[model samples]
Target: MEEKSFLDRMLGHLRETCKYYTGYPKYLGPSRVIHFTSEREFVQLLHQGYPVVVAFTIRGNYTKHLDRVLEEAAAEFYPHVKVLRVECPKYPGFCITRQRKEYPFIEIFHSPEQAANQGRVADPNITKYSVKVLPFNYDQSAYGFREFFKRHGIRSSPDPK
Candidate 1:
């Protein structure tokens, strides 16, 4: 009985360690979409100099649909545009300030240099970061996102590092 109990505890610990390393289990996949985990992660992503597409969404079919679109876009625009999604319900405190009246609010954040060249102003809400945030109000499709990225000068191919 003692050995069985010890084994169970070991298994439980292993499970938790896997969860920590893999991130939210539901999001584990080949998809390039980076699940928003912390403000620190967000800041790091912004500083990487790639255009980031952030989607603030609640749990719903529409959010799932948007996730699929973003996954496709991220796959196509790898190394050029990074895609992230913050589930509002999961992180209410983090999303509270960025939330909109509607669900699945989308925003594209441009790097500081890119924003400056385009004459875009930095978002006051994100004072610490110099990224320019533009509300995405176009069609919610992979093609739409690709076109939007193209329009904003995000190259379809990865920039030569």
Candidate 2:
């Protein structure tokens, strides 16, 4: 069997999320939209010690894959890894604080894996993430995302890595 590349591995998780998403409305909270109201709420996501894929949306450019990513993470990893989609309009201050220069991408919190798949060379000072802010990408494939989470120490699947 051929070994999967990081992107393939990550995309696999999103593909598999469909199974769990069909029932999303039944058990999860509020209408499909997810939000982070405060810095504390945002920190709460990262504090879980798991990787959180936080998407920043603006001007109606919806990030479609993130929902699948969230569903997949919830289905496969449950409390281990998660995705939070925040609308930039409602959270104007949040965006300003992060100094966001781009829109419609995923912002990860509490992750130290260098975003190897997302393309920023691994930050040399892993500890700096606690105080300094880092830029993130939202362009990787779903398979790549799963590997990103696992590589960062957030285990999601029952399958052996």
Using TM-score as the measure, which candidate wins?
A: 1
Kindly list the per-residue Cα lDDT of model 1 for residues 1-161, writing each as its tens digit. 34568887886667655523233333334889899999889888888888888899888887777877787677667777899999888888877876477888899987654233434448645433366788898887667787777687766665588
lDDT assessment of candidate 1: 0.75
TM-score of 2: 0.53
Candidate 1 stretches greater than 4 Å from native: 1-29, 113-127, 159-161
**Candidate 2 Cα outliers beyond 4 Å, as residue runs:** 1-34, 59-62, 111-141, 157-161
Evaluated at residue 133, the lDDT of candidate 2 is 31
lDDT for position 19 in model 2? 39
- For candidate 2, which ten residues in a row score worst on lDDT? 126-135
The lowest-lDDT stretch of 10 consecutive residues in candidate 1 is 19-28
41: Cα error in model 2, Å: 2.0
Error of 1 at 31 (Å): 1.3
